[model samples]
Structure formats: C-alpha cells, structure tokens
Target chain A: MSDVKTTALVWISPSTWPACVDAARERAPDDHVVLLHVGDDRIAAEAHRAYAGLLGRGHGPERDPGSRLEALSGVAGADLLEKAAHRLGRPCELLDRHGRPQEEVIRAAADADLLICARDGDPERPGPHSLGPESRFVVDHAPCPVLLVWPHRT
Target chain B: MNSLAAEIVSVGLLLGVLAFAVARPRGLPEAVAAIPAAGLVVVLGAVSPADAWEQTHTLLPVVGFLAAILVLAQLCDDDGLFDAAGDLVARFCGGRPVRLLGGVFGVAAVTTAVLSLDATVVLLTPVVFVTASRVGAHPRPHVYACTHLANSASLLLPVSNLTNLLAFTASGLTFTRFAVLMALPWLAAIAVEYVVLRRFFAADLAVGAHPPKEAEQRTVPTFTLVVLGLTLLAFAVTSLIGIEPLWAAFAGTAVLAARALRRRRTTLPALWRAASPLFCLFVLALGIVVKAVVDNGLDTGISRILPGGESLTTLLAIAAVAALLANLINNLPAILALLPVVAPAGPGPVLAALIGVNLGPNLTYVGSLATLLWRRVLHEHDSAPSLGQFTRLGLLTVPATLIASTVALWGTLQL
Candidate 1:
C-alpha cells in the first residue's frame, strides 16, 4: 500500500447524523474524517424580510429578531457539531458553516476524496424519493465520490 | 381623457399597484409601487389633483396613528415586553404542551387586541418560537396561535387592526361604543379559534417536557408592564376626552422611547426607522390610488352587490361578501372598496363589514398584511406550516367564527 489515507467529508444533519457518522467509522476506518454541519440561514433571512416589510429597514439591528435568531442558530449548530464529534469518538476535523446546507456541503467536499451523507426523505421508499431536496442536490453536484447511507434499517 | 378610457386605465393601474404590493418584487418597499401608481392615476387624469390632495388630507390622521403605534410596539419589544410574556407563559405552563397552547392563545389575543396584529407577528412570534424550543414543546401549535389570533382576536378594538381603524373613522362611533359593539363578537371569535386550534393540533400538544433550568430564571420586566397598563388607560381616557386616539399612542411611544433611550436600549434613528416613513407613505399613496378607483365608479358596482340594511340577514350578507372580497383582494383594499358602499347604510353594516375584513384573512396567507408578515416570521423560525395545512385550518375556523361573530354583532345591535 502507498500508506496515503483517503479524506472523507461527512455531512451531519439533525435527522440523519448518526448514519453518516457510522458510515464514516465503518467504511473509512483509517481515513481522515471531516465532520461538516451547515446552519440554514434562510430562516434568518426570512425573519429579516418580515421585519423590513412590516417595521421598515431603518430600525437598528439590535431591535431585529433575525440577527438574534441567527446567533441562536449558530450556538445550536456548534452544539450539534460537538455532539456529533463526541459520537464519532475518533479524531476528526469539525467544519461549521452557514447558508444553504446543500451548497455548503458541496463546497466543503471539494478537497475530500469521498463525501458521506444519509438519505433524509421517505424511509419506506426505495427510489429518488428516499432523498430530500438538499441531499439530492448534494448527491448530484458533489465534486467527490459520495457514500449515501440509509438513516435506519428498512 | 374620456370617461371610458379613464375608468379602464384607473382599474389597470390599481391592479398593478396591488400586484406589486402583494408580490413585493425583489423586496422593494410597498411605497415603490403605490407612490408611482398614485402619481400615474393623478397624472393620467384618472383622478383629479384636487381629489388626490383631499384623499391625502383625509388619511393623515390614520397614517399618523399607524406610525405612532408602530413605534410604541417597537419600543415595547425593545423593553422586553414580548419576551417577558413568552417567558411567563413557558414558566407557567409547567411543561404541558396543551396548557402552553392555551397560554399562548390568551397572550396572543391580548397582544393583538392591545398593540395591533403586526406586533403579535413581528415581535411575539419569535419569542414564542424560542420559548417553545427552550421548553422542549413542539412549536407549531403555539406559533399558530399567534397568527390566528392576530387576525381573529383583532375584532375587539378600533386600534386592533388597520382595517378596524378605517372602519372606525367611517362608522362615526365613539371608541368606547365601538369596543362595546365588538366585545361579544371578539369573545365569540376567540372562543371559536381556541376550540378549533386545540382540536386541529391535538397531536402536537399531546407531549411536553420541562423547560431548561436556565429558562426558568428569566425575569419579567415590570416597568414595561406598568407603562403598557397606563397606556391602555390612556386610550380610554383620550377617547372620552374627544380627541384622536393617536395622542394616547404617541404619549405611550414617547414614554417608552425615552426610557429605552435613557437606558441605552434604543436610539433615535432606530425609533425613526421603526416608525417606517416608507410604510406610512405607502398607506398615503394607497389611499390616493383607492380614491382614484372609487372615483372611477367602482363603488357603484360594489353598492349594487352589497345588501343594504341592519337586519340579521342583511348583516350576514354584508359580512359574507366582505369576507369573499377580502380574500380576493387583500383586506386593506377590500375594506377600502367596500367602506364607501356600506358606510351609507349606517353602523350595523359597517361593523359587519369590519367583522368580515378582520376575520376573513384567517383563510389565506394573502388575506391580510399581518398574515403575510406572520408567514414570514414562521418561515424564519423553521416552522412554516404548509399552504394546505394553513388553508385547512382556515376553512375550519373562518366560517364558524364569521357566523358566530356576525350573529353576536347583530345581537349587540339589538341591544
């Protein structure tokens, strides 16, 4: 063997985090694992729009609940990443990002050898419906090879 | 311009303005659409310059009151009134989701009735969302209560909704008399909403968990509560003193803004922005556009369709038509279109139309500006209910509340 380990990027979401983590450990045992969690800021943007629409854009940022929500989401995202790292119980790089979750995952996977994620849609189905829109987009657009795992045994 | 061409152009311009207002293409301010449309109407000779000026003059007080209330609501939010209410609700619910739902309903009703529906959506929705998450309760039911009551519970006071404010000006009733007339209807509508929401979201409310220990330590802001109480008292006093109620709202906003400023909680620029000159201008411009439409003979068509009388059947017909029209063209314009026609028949029809415009928005997202704002709030909190789900709930609640409240209004009229 050349003794060069593969780099795997594992995408973590609140719903299917365990499956991705387990896949990283089982299939890429000796690989360098990078755990990625993306905080969706669309909600924050939506809140800002609501504020601007009703309250006007002149109000200071301190009065906006959108920025407050974004901060809270960041804290929650970090906490989740920590919990995910703890569950992996092995050395891994934790990458926390914000924006569209699928786009962030695809961007983070650019330097990795493999992208690992879980099917987040209908568990009972056995077709494309099994993947959510974000995961579907990630699978279709990822720069690296992808390992898609079922969240639970069907 | 010939009368026929003027009428066609005026209607076309009005439609374009409403489309831009509703779609808000690329998030432009509503005034961006309305001001231009208003100018076009005047310039096209669809409305006389004198008529447009008259419309602006008539709308000044309503717009002034609206600005004051927006400021008051923002300062109150800055003072932590909504957060305190949410915290109190979470603390008292004792980890039961159903109880939390009821608590949210009560608080939302009061907030909408007192501060207007926009406050409940823009300020209280996020607080309730955070509170639900902290308590480990599913947030759907609680947050839905905020939006639903923002529309239905707004039946109580003239100041509760912008539509009510318009109707109040045209209805020629004292503030106390308006509240007294709408009191029973408000109670009935709220009751129907509570019952329907509880049953609709029963599964979500079936489970609950205790709030995190840290959440329990949050303190309520007492000074804000006292000021709010005194503000409510001032509304009644100002009404009795025979002055525009905007004075009371201005006083409340001034006191709260001063306290917020002294405490370094808010700034003057922030206060000015919260007052939202763009939105005020949108309202004024909208008034001019609507005047152009009415002047072009839209009211004659509306008058033919709207039944004229104060009888129970007539009230129901007026309310039903108002509700349908409200859903078709957002409530603000709907009320504007219907008011001139209904106001001539007296307070009974005007109040009935009020009930319709206020309660009708529960049926669709586009039914009211407050509903649209509430939808945005829900989307940001990651708890957006689906269109189908929202409509199903509306179908269950709107008809029941409408009939119950209209009957109640007719009963009050009898008294």
Candidate 2:
C-alpha cells in the first residue's frame, strides 16, 4: 500500500549488482522484484543478421541477440537476485529478455511497478564516452519510475 | 596625453584586447589567464608597489583562517562526508525530478558554502551525471544546478573559495558580514534556477534510492586535524614573523602536500588541476589591475562618478559597475581594478559587489571560472549552441542578479 511496491524491474549492472540487490531487498516487496536484462544472445543475433545482410549469405543458424552478453548478464543477474532474495528472506523472479539491452530493459519496466538500476561501473570512462545513448534513451522513456542505486555517498 | 586622448587610448586598447580574445580564446587558456595577472601587475607597477601590496599586521588573521579552513574541508571531503548528505537530500525529494533538483541545489549550496566550489563541483559532478542517467533525466538541468550552486554559494563565506577570499581580503570585509550580504540573494538565485529548470528535467527520475547494508562508515585516518592545527599555528607564527600572506599560503600547501599522503594514498591531482585556471586567472588579473590602478590612481575621475557623499550610495554604484564590467573583462581584473580605488565601502558594498561579480558569470559563459568549465565540458569536441548558449544564460542571469543584488545592497544599508 506504500509508494515503493509499484517498482516492476530491477536492473543490475555487474559492478553495482551487489548494491542494487541490497537496495531492492529493503525497498521492493515480495514478488514485485523482477531481475531483467537485455540478453547477450539477442545482441549476437542482431550482429549475425547484419553480417548476412551485408554478404548476401544464406540464413545462418538462428542466433540469439547479445548471446555472449546475455549469458554473462544472466549469470550475474541470477546470482545477485538469488543473493538478494536470500538476504531479504523472500522469493523473487528472474526475467531475462533477449534483445538490444535498452529495449529489453524498457520492456521489463513495462511489466513492473518501478525500475531500479545499480550505478556500479568503472569510475573513469574508457575515453570520452559517458552515459551512452541507450542509457540516455531509456531514462527519457521508461514506463515507470527508475531508481539509480550506488554505494550511498558518505 | 590630453584627457580626451587618454580616454580614446583606453577605449582603443580595450577594444583590441576584446577582439584578440574573441578571435581565438581556446588555444590561449594560459595566456588568457596570464592577461589578468599581467594587467594587474602593470597597474601596480605604475603605482607605488609598496602601497598596493602594503601589509597591515592586523589583517593577517583572516588569511590564516582561510588557509586553515581549506584543510578542514579537504579532510571532510576525503572522508566522503557529503555522500551521506546527498542521500539525505535524495531521500527527502523522493522520486520527483523537480523535488530532486531543488534538493540538489540546496545541498550543493551548503556544501559549496562550507567547502570551496571546486571541491564541491569535483565531488558532485560525477554523482550528478550518474544520478541523472539513473533517474532517466537529461544531465543538462542538473549540470545547470551544479553551476548555479557554485555561483550562489560563492558568497557564503570569506573562506568559501577564492573569489570571496579575494573580495574580502582586497576590500577588508569580515567573514560574518560577507555571509550576511550573500544569504538572501544566494537563496533567491537558487530558488529561481530550480523553478526555471524544473519542467525541463526528466519526469520523477530516481537513480537507485536505497543504501547498501554494508556501506563503509570508517573515518579517514586524519591529517585533517594535523593540517588544521599546523595551518593555524603557521598562520599565527607567520603573522608574528611578518611573512607575506601569499607566500605563507604557498608554504602551508607545500607542507601539507608533503605529509598528506597516508600509506601511499595518492593526493588528488584533480584538486590542483580543478581550480588552477581560475587561480591563474585571479593571479594574472591581480597583476593587471594593480598596474591599471598605478596608472589611474585610487580616485580616477571614473572612480568618483557616484557624485554622492553617502558611503552606501557610492559603494553600491561601484559594485554595480564592477559586476557589469566583470562579465566582459571577467571578475579577476574587474575586482583587482576596483578594490583599491573604492576606498572602504563598509562590508555592505564590498560584500554585494563581490556577490555580483562572482555570480555575474551566470549571465554569460565567460563570466566565471565555474561557468566556463561547464561550457567547455558540455561543448567538448562539438559545439552545443556554442558560446551563444552561455551568453543566453548570462542574459537572463545578469539582469536577475543585478536586480536582486540591488535589493540586497539597499537592505544591508537599511539594516
């Protein structure tokens, strides 16, 4: 009945997975927390499809988009969700979507009450790229409120 | 030279400097910086350097206090004290973009007021950018808020940052008096900025709002206390020994830098780099303005244009002109140029004008170090609305600040 239960998707970045999971346990209700990500399988498929289009080759074996990232993200997402559920002493669902990372994350938000993201990443950017377009796009159009979780500043 | 010839010569030379700076400003950040200090030097060179650089033993305590304050601030930041403070603000605002903007501004004001603006900006800019992405809001509004906070917070204390430090020391205003002039106008600017920016930010953006269960709470093994004690001790010792204040500051910074590292914890290179452009600009302006004063004398005809016997009236007039000039020429030279000529204007005009010059940058991109840095970051390799973006912001800010500033000056004198 409170303001927080409406959160629908909890997205975890690899570095911040620990912190986001912890925030969710405290704030998200049982069953309200869904671990969602754009599976690497989906991204891989997109790349393959593009390659085939360029070369005019026969249809390649069906490949999921972001196949590798999806696998890695899946393991990370599942591990954190399980750890969080255990800590909260509750049950939670792991929702994975195989597509471009941004689209899948948006779709997950559509089904949930709120979207929570853990802000765990390399402190400095690799070069000048900061807040890639996908993150910027999702922020502008997410279906519901999203929380940016970080190690609570001092 | 005849008076007319001198006036014409001043105008011609002034136009030349502006044209040259405009023709290409980016490549010569250092030389552009050197101009103000160099100009100040020329002015002082023309005058009695002994008088312009004169030391009054009684004035020494204020300098010492500012140096000590910087050490204390460095310690608190090293411990990340402001992070908890940010969470508290975020918690209060909940999930609304507008509420969050206001909260961020409020916290930034206090933080920048307590520490220097550079420290506040360094700690907060990364967090704000990340937080904006999390909340799904454009970083623009938050970026604007950060800059505005710096501007408003500039007036908070004599030791809050260099502009206030310069204004206070050059004009002989006290700490509490400086804060008093700044309080209302600073708050008003924050309120206006938040209100204007509210609708433009993302809709109820929230970066993960919860804290980690295991977040660290340990204190930084402190050189803060040691630094503070040493700074104060040195300050006292220096005044007794009659060391110049600038040299004393440099000595303290060297002493602290030598011992600040713990277990090879690297000192933040960003700390020195973050505000150097501004410091260089200030030093450079100090040189130029001193030179100008030497040529002009303490009461050039222009300096006495107020035509009023009232100290308050004259003071306000000087501050008003100084603020306007600072936008084009920038505050360093503007303040350096005016501080000696203005006589003692009570803490009122001195405080108000200092607020105006520091905040005046809000009116244009080139106005203050904070605005210029933001402009560069946002523009980066590509130009986003270019310098014109800053000019527009300044157009709004200059009139708004001046109007609010006039009221503050009037009220201060009334009280």
Candidate 3:
C-alpha cells in the first residue's frame, strides 16, 4: 500500500469550469484532494465571511473553516472531481478552506503535487488545468512540480 | 473684403479661438468638438448649403448615423458586453503594462479602423482604462493615441474612423478604394508608432502579479469569458452585416446594461446622460467652424498668401497649410476650415489636405482628439515618459508621419 498525501486547492468561479476539476480528482492520492480556499486576514478573522458579512454579526455562513464549498463552486467542483476520480478508478473527498484564496492556495501548494485551476473557465474543459492569477502563482511558486491542466481549445 | 474672404477670415479667427479653447475645455468633448463646430458656422455663413460646396448636402446623414451609433452603444453597455470583454482583455494581458500597452494600441487601431473611431472608443475605453490602471500606465497617452490613431487608422478603411465617415458622407469615397490606397502608409505609421513609443509607454508596475484575495471571498461569477465572447462576437457580426455599427452597439448595450440598471448603478445612466451633452458640444463646435469657414471669410486670404493654386507649388503649399492649421487649431476644424479653400486645387491637393490634417496630430498632443485622449490617461511611474520626453518622440515622429502622408497623398496626383 502507498502512503503519500497530496492536497489540491481551487479558488475559481465554478460557472466557467466543471470539466477540468473532474480530471484532477482521478490523479490525487485519495482519489480526492484537500480543497482549501483561504481568504484575506480581515475576512478570516471576522465571525462571518463573504458577502454575508454585510448582513451583520452572528448572521453569516456559520460553517467550520475546513468544510463546505460555495454551493455554486461546490456543485461544479464536486461533480467534476468525482467524474475524474471515477475515470481513474480512484476515490476522493472534497474539502473547502474559507480564508484568503491566494494564501490558502499557497498553503495547499505545500501539500499538493498538483493544484488544478480552470483556464478562463472553459466548461467543456480538458484534463485538469490552471489559468488566471491564482493558477499562475501556484505554478510559479508551488512546493512541487505543478501539472497545469488546460482546456482543449482544438 | 468679399464674402469669400470674410468666410475664410472667420474660419481662421474661429480656429484661433478654438486654439484657446483647447487649453480650457468646459467639458471633455468640448476639446474634440471645437473644430467641427467652427467649421459648420464658417461654412454655413459664407454661402448656403447649396451655394457653398456641392458636397455639403450629403453630409446630412452623419447625424442619423452618429446618433444611431451612440444610442445603440448605450443600449449594449446596458448589457455588460463591454465589461465582460474588458475583463478578458485584462485577464489575458493581466499585469504586464508593456504587453498591455502594445495590445491596447493594436486593439484600438484595429477596432477603430474596423468599427469607426466613435464606436471603437465607446466600446474599448472602459477596459483600456482598467488595464491601464493596473499596470500604472497613464490612461492619458493611451486615450490620446487611440483617439488620433482611431481617426488616422480609419482613413485606410472608409468604415474605420469618423473622419472617414464624414469624408464618405461629404464625398464619394468608398470603403474598398480607401483601404487599397492607404494601406501601406498606414502600416508604416503604425509600425513606427509602436516601435518608437511602446518602450516609453511601459507599465509603472508589474500588472496582474498581485491577484487580490478577493477571488475566493468575492465571487464575481466567472462570466468574464462568456461576456467577452458574446460582446466581441456581437460587435463583429454587426460590422459584418453592414447593420451600421451604432445600431449593433445599441442592441448589445441593451443586454450588458441590464444588470447595471437593475442594480440601480448610477454609472449606467451617467453614460446615457453623456450622449446629449456630447451632441450639443459637437453641434456647437461644428456650427462655429462652419460659421468661421463660410461667414467670416478666411480662404481668399490663404490663397493670396500662397499663389499658384494648381501647380506642384499649390500642392506643397496646401500641405504646409494643413499641417500648420492642424498644429495651431484642432485637426478636425483645420480640415473643415480648409476644405472650401482647397476646392479649386483638384483631388491632388484636396487629398493633401485630408492626409496632412489626419496625420498632423503627431506634431502635438492638442493637435488631434486622439492625441488629447492619449495625453489624458498616461500613468505616472518610473517607466512612463514625461510630457517633455513624449514630445521629443512626437517631434521626430510627427514630421516623419507627415512626410510619409504627404508622399501617400502625392500618389493621388500623377505629378
């Protein structure tokens, strides 16, 4: 039995991507990856995170920091991640981090052999890919070799 | 003085007046519209539309066309097409100012030439401004060059710039013929401009390098791609359909502006509100220009000042006049004010007036609307050149562009 752990962080709009994430799931150690969407310090310290913070104290998303995904982002991500895991004949678990995305993503990179990001959100998608600012940063400064997933434009 | 002399003098004086106005614009459009208004007042005053120039009546359609373009663009802006497109441009060029500047220059030149200056500016400025800020490139030079190049590049295609639009309205020029003739020199000017100016225009900071933590916190629905595709596709289709760029703009703006409207964003209506004011300004300036050209009389004075109206001497003389007028007053007004005077010089010198005036903006920022816009948005950073530095390039490039344009105009005449 192999005993290596890999973490993958995603901080992209799910609307533009559902396919690339599916591919990432098949490749991760657990047939799934630890998804961390860290946030900024201000928001991280707040009792409430996200737009809900505007609604006032004690009235925002009251979930633990390491669980649950944005309904929109989660559906897209979970569905895609599961699809890819199935393709690889592996099993995976979906996780979420609610801190600053870049910082969380960087932290994720420490444990990640591969960080998957959607390239400009191409829905049809290719294998796991990375695009945009977050993805670029991960690739350039990640702890390990970064496998950039790209959309099959052709 | 005779009515002709009076009209020419009026135009000349009006031009001098506008030169002052350029230094003090009551509004943004005022700076650009001054030349056109002065032309209208001068021309209409000198002679009746029928009596003055045979081509005057044909220009009437410009109002409908420009209005249509404005209204349509307003509606599409309502749709979010531009926002989407802008985001994509930003994302692609992201944080690199040098790439962004080059991209903007390329995009602006191509779009302005393809879609007409008025339409191109209306559509592109939002994104260009945002990207410019990220890279810390001043929006001034970008806007300025885009304006001038918008008009200048449009000359190659009758469909490209408003000047070409007006020229088309006022003359019998066709799209194909114009593009075929001016393509080479247009290519040269753009090449020179990019090479000479791109380095100086490099960004003040590394763009797109610092992705805000907001990507995860504030989910702005990944519509950047969708919106970009939709807007670009729509605009391209409209241009292809010959549906009149303005009408296409209105349709698209309607869709994009919907969200902004629903959000009660004052920004949306503010854009619409800009239309009437711009119209009024251009109308006022055009009226003044026409009055100056027709009623006050400045041509016979120009003619007397430079003899031999048809020879090579006249060609060179009018070219010099166009260049001088462009620098002294706004290029639009300079072109309009001198149009009547050059009527006797045949297509050759008439062509000279057109080309020289169009290319003359390179001489000074105030010389062209495009130049003015470029001057307005330049980012202040270590890399961005100061006005004096930019001017040094302009001094060299403007004359070179002018000389090249003169040669291009020379082709129109067998001489």
Candidate 4:
C-alpha cells in the first residue's frame, strides 16, 4: 500500500462517481486514490445558519437538504473507492467536504499529486460536448494537472 | 448656459458609467458599478458638493425605507416563507399543472406587491421551478409567471418597485392616494398577463401531473405576518398624519431588527452589510445627471412636442411615448428623463408615465434592471428563456397590458 508513490485526488458526485473512479484509475493506475466528495451545502446552510444563529439553535448541516446529497455521495463514494482500490491493489482514502464543490476540490488538492474529475453533466445544454460550470471552473483554476474524462458520446 | 460644457461632460460620464454598471463587466458588484459615477459628478463640479449633499439628504428616507423592506423580505425568505408557499401550491394543486400555474401567479404577485419585485425574481423563481419539477409539470409557464407577475403586479403599491417609489415621491401623492389611483391599473395589468400567459403556455399546461411528495411544512411566522400588517397600516396612518412613510418603515424595521437581534437570529453587521448605501448615491448621481440634461435644453426640446392637454388622449399619448422610451434606453433612465418633462403636465399623465415605465419593460429583455436580474436568476437555474420566446410573450402581453392599464389609470382619473 505504501509502496505506491503517486497520489491522485478524484472529485466525485453521485452521478459522476463511476466515471471519475475509472478516470482516476486510468490516469494513475498504480497511484493511491483519494475520493473527495464536496457537498453543496453552502447556500442553504448559510440561510439555516442565519436562522439558527438568530434562534441560538446551532443546527448543523445535517438538517438541510444539502446533507442528504452529501450522505449519498459518501455512501456511493466509499463503495466506489473500495472497488477502485481492489482493482488497483492499493490502499485508497475516501474524504467528504461540504461547501462550494470547486473550492473544496481545489483546497483538498493541496496534497494531491494529480487531480481527476469527470466532465460533469449540464442540464442547460443537451449534447455530448456540454460541460458543467463547476467542471470548467475546476479545469481552469486547479493548481495541479487535471485529468477530465468526457462522458462516452451517445 | 454657463455650464454647458460641464453639463455635457456630466451627462456623458453618467451615461457611460451607467452602461458599464448595467453591463457589469468582470462581475463587478452593484456598489462598485454605481459609486464611482456618483464621485465623478462631484469631482467634476458638474454637481456642486453642496447640491450632492442635498440630493443625498433627500434620498436618505427612501433608502432607509427600501432597506427595511429588503430586511423584512430576507428574514421571511430565511424562515422558509417562499419555500413553504411553493410546497403548499404543489401539495394543494393535487398535481394539476393549470392549478399550479394559478398558484405560481398568486405567490409571485403577492411577493411582488409586498416584498418588492426583486424578491419575487430572486427568491420565488427557483422555488417555482422546484415545485413544477416535483409535480412533473412543464416548468416554463410557471417560471414565466415569476417575471411577468413581478412587473405587472408590482403596480399596486409605492413600495412594490423602485420606480413606483420614484413616482410616488414625484407625484407627491399620499400612500393611500397612490394605491387608490393604481388599483385599477394593477388589476388590469395582472388580468391581461394572466390571460396571455395561459394562452401562450396552454400546450405545456395540458401535461399529466405526478403526485407530489408530502413536503415538511414549517409553521408560518404569525408574529412576522402581524408585524407586516401593522407596517402597512402605519403607511396609511402616517400619510394621513402628513408624516413621511420612512418613519413607519423605520418603526417596523426597528421592531423586526430588535426581535432578530434579541433572538440571536441575525447580527447587526450582517444587516448593515446587506443594506446598500450605494443605491442612494446612485439615485442622487443619476438625479444630477438628469438635471444636467434638463438644464442643457433637453427639457425645452421635449417640451415643444410634449402634447399639451388634460384630455385622456394626452395622458395615453404621454404613456405611449414613455413606454417607447423605456424600451429604447431602459425604464430608470427613461423615467429620469421623462419625469420633469411630464411632471409639469400634472399627476394624471405622471401616473400614466409610471404605468408605461413599470409595465412597458416587459416588451424587451433589456427594458428594466429587474428583467436583467430575472434573466440571470433563470440562467442559474438552467432555464434561460430564449430571447425570441421572451419577445414573443412580451409582444403578446406588453401592449395589451400597457394599453389596458393606461386606460384603467384614465378611468381612475375620471372617477
């Protein structure tokens, strides 16, 4: 496990987890993979935080709808991380950060030797070439080299 | 014209800066866009420092009133007022798309009338989309309702739109009088929009609906609602007593702010951060620029052709011209340009011009700042309405609503 010198951080969403894992393995086959799921809880949590702060309830992110997505990401991400480790025969780590996904992915990439991500889907455009704004932002701003796996053209 | 060159420079700088602010290159914030133009007017001596101070002083009450309304809206939004409204509509509609459309109109109209059109656009658009999705309805009609009603329904009250506030200030009508004169036009505009929107989206509205999941309902904030009622009542009472509406707004704001602070729901710094002083500065700066235009012969130039009469025809003509001008350069500047031109013509035409500036902006995407903001909000939700689609709807709705509402205003004057 410690023998693998390469470290890859892969951003995972529930929809994009499978493609991300595959892309991560393809980029660094012998590298230790760390799956990072960034929950989008900032907007609603800000509202809740203000509401709770006013009332002194101090409710955590769990009470918001965003946490449900975070929970799903965690469960699916861990399972995918486990499968990827088995296939690569190396130890892998699964981590979750909650906030703006792109910002979290960038911050979590501090120790990552390579950043892996799937070209996230976009509801605004219908085509094989469409890219989510977050994916574009990550590609443009990521400090480390980014490997974006495009979805298979239908 | 001792200050001809200075006035030209002032107007030129104001127009250029306003365009930049509206276009907002590099995602500049609102204050960043508005504040510098204000500073330039003073620095250029186009507006004397003493006059700038006087102009800003006049705008203070309006700013305070608007800020308080904004705080109230934000607090209501935080307490899930909009989300709960959406959920109630979804649950109560029994998954019927048409009923849901009615619900959307109702919620958007009330939100616009009470909290301002900005609130309707910013807070209610996404909730409408989510509710439509949950019920398996086509979201287009419901989504369009948010923008259409935001403009048309906002005609009823002085606080409904910033333009209304400006008109209110200029008309010198008490709060109750403004509401009375606008009541018929407001109904007319909303009715026209409702009929047009339903017809345009008839095909979409015919889709089968899905059973909505039971949404967790939060208790409506009865205390907040009661305070809102008292605030509105205070508007009428203060007007009767010849007090500025600002005092009433401030009273309500103080109560709400105190409650929030005591309950530890929000902080003073947060409220201060949210309240923009730049808007007051922008209004003052724009007033100075418009004064320059008025001084440099634009007023006299407009006056010669400015159909002089007290007839309904005259009122409608002024409204028609205003509507056209609003489409040309957007409503804010148009109103700033036309206000002095029409004010001397008296209150009937001024209110008609108000109708034109308020309802006419639905004619084009660039007709108002609220529309621009509405478009951006829609884009964030991944539902940008195409320009052609927006125009087509606007063409169907704007003229009909504008004419009908102007006619209603004429009727009010007759009464």
Give the candidate number with the greatest TM-score. Answer: 1
Candidate 1 per-residue lDDT, tens place, B8-30, comes to 88778766776666555555777
lDDT of 3 at B236: 48
Best by lDDT: 1
Q: Which ranges in model 2 have alpha carbons more than 4 Å from their true place?
A: A1-154, B1-78, B81-88, B199-259, B267-285, B288-290, B297-301, B307-317, B368-392
lDDT of 1 by residue, A1-154 (tens): 7888889999987546777898988999899999998876654544443343333422344655567667866776786688789988998899999877888899999999999998766565667667766788999999999999987431
lDDT of 2 by residue, B1-415 (tens): 4434434444444434433333234434334534544444435344344543542222344344444445545545555555555555545545445566777787678767765665454455445544443333334455556665666566665556655766767665444455666777666666556655553232222222333223433343345445544654554455446553445455555555555455243366633432233324324334443444435443475456634333555555665676776665656545555555553645665665676676665554244333444335335634233344335554665566666655665666677
**Model 4 interface RMSD, in angstroms?**
13.9
Q: Score the docking of each candidate (DockQ).
A: 0.08, 0.03, 0.02, 0.03
Could you tell me how far off, in angstroms, the CA of residue B61 lies in candidate 1 after the best superposition? 0.5
Residue pairs in clash, model 1: none
lDDT on C-alpha atoms for all candidate structures: 0.79, 0.50, 0.47, 0.68
- Winner of 1 and 3 under DockQ: 1
**lDDT at position B110, candidate 1:** 93
Ranking by TM-score: 1, 4, 2, 3
lDDT of 3: 0.47
What RMSD, rounded to one decimal, does every model reach?
7.0, 14.5, 15.5, 11.3
- Candidate 3 local Cα displacement, residue B220, angstroms: 14
User: In candidate 3, which residue ranges exceed 4 Å CA deviation?
Assistant: A1-154, B1-58, B72-78, B94-97, B118-126, B132-148, B199-297, B300-320, B341-351, B367-387, B405-415
Cα misplacement distance, residue B8 of candidate 4 (Å)? 4.0
